[model samples]
Target: MHSFVYLASQSPRRSQLLEQIGIAHRLLVAQDHDPEPQDPEALEQVLPRESATDYVQRVTGLKLDAAIARLQRRGLEQAPILCSDTTVSLGRHILGKPESQEQAREMLQALSGKTHRVLTAVALQSGRKRLTSLSVSSVEFAVMDSAQIDAYVASGEPMGKAGAYGVQGRAAAYIARISGSYSGIMGLPVFETANVLRAAGFAI
Candidate 1:
């Protein structure tokens, strides 16, 4: 059993989720000055005709691969490494993080009075072994007028969140119903993550 794991994600929610489970982990984020850096934006680019499930899982795998390489490059101590990716989709349309307030407002408007699927994929690498899991949740937003959408966007909470909103933030007021893991909607699924960690020989 390992004493701790390495989490290769910039999302503080993921880290908070891990902490909630009593899992000790250190961030293994890439540095700008690294000789070989992974471009997060490039890695998250949606491919033509890609399904939400495929996109989230593929991105998680790619992130794990990059993290594994990062560990080797840094000669870090041997331990399990965890990586995850989340995407919000309404049918075939994948809603990624909004680049600007206008985009955020547009996403919020589209999601109004509708239910969308939030898919989160988690991957773990331990020694020569790798494991993965996916969690899918549905969130329904109540009908919102332009003012409501604009108010939320003005709060700036949707700027860096997938689906242009965070379930645990001010956006929660507009969430009429949630049919899946709340933690998953926040960017990490605790149940799925704990299972993956256990599979990787961690004593979650």
Candidate 2:
């Protein structure tokens, strides 16, 4: 068991969650100079007829593979490498990060007074072995008028988050209820994350 592992994600929230659980991890994010720097965003493009579960798992595995290769390229010492991916789904439709303010508004409006699924997949690579886990949670939203949607969009909090809103932010005001892991909706599910880490032989 190692004292710390490599976390290959750009989300600050993931780092904070790991710290919250007393897991020491080193950030192993992709750099602009990386050989496949564009792979991060490219991997997220939804495939034709891809279910949310498959998409999240596939993307998480891809990220782990990339990170494993990256670690070897850098000649870094061997330790478990972790990666995660999250997506919002309304039925089979995957709601990705909004490209514009209007799109953000549309996503929020569509989610009003409805239920959606938030799926987060975590993958861990230890030596030549790999492990993965998934967390699925349902969220119910209160009715939001046009004004509410517009104001939330204007806050600029929906731009980079899946489902056009962050669960830990102002959007929580409109969430009437949630039926799964709150940490998963925030980007990384600490429970599933800890499972993979322990499976990879981490002391945590």
Residue lDDT tens for model 2, 1-204: 788989999899999998988898999977877767545668788889889999999989888888887898889888888889989999778998898999999999899999999999998888878888999999999999999999999999998899999999999999999999999999889998888888877777
Give per-model TM-scores: 0.97, 0.96
Off by over 4 Å in 2: 35-38
Tens digits of per-residue lDDT for model 1, 1-204 = 899999999999999999999999999988877955667789999999989999999999999999989999999998889999999999779999999899999999999999999999999998888889999999999999999998889898999899899999999998999998999999889999999888877776
Using TM-score as the measure, which candidate wins? 1
Q: Which residue pairs clash in candidate 2?
A: none
Candidate 1 weakest ten by summed lDDT: 31-40
Give the root-mean-square deviation of each candidate in angstroms: 1.0, 1.2
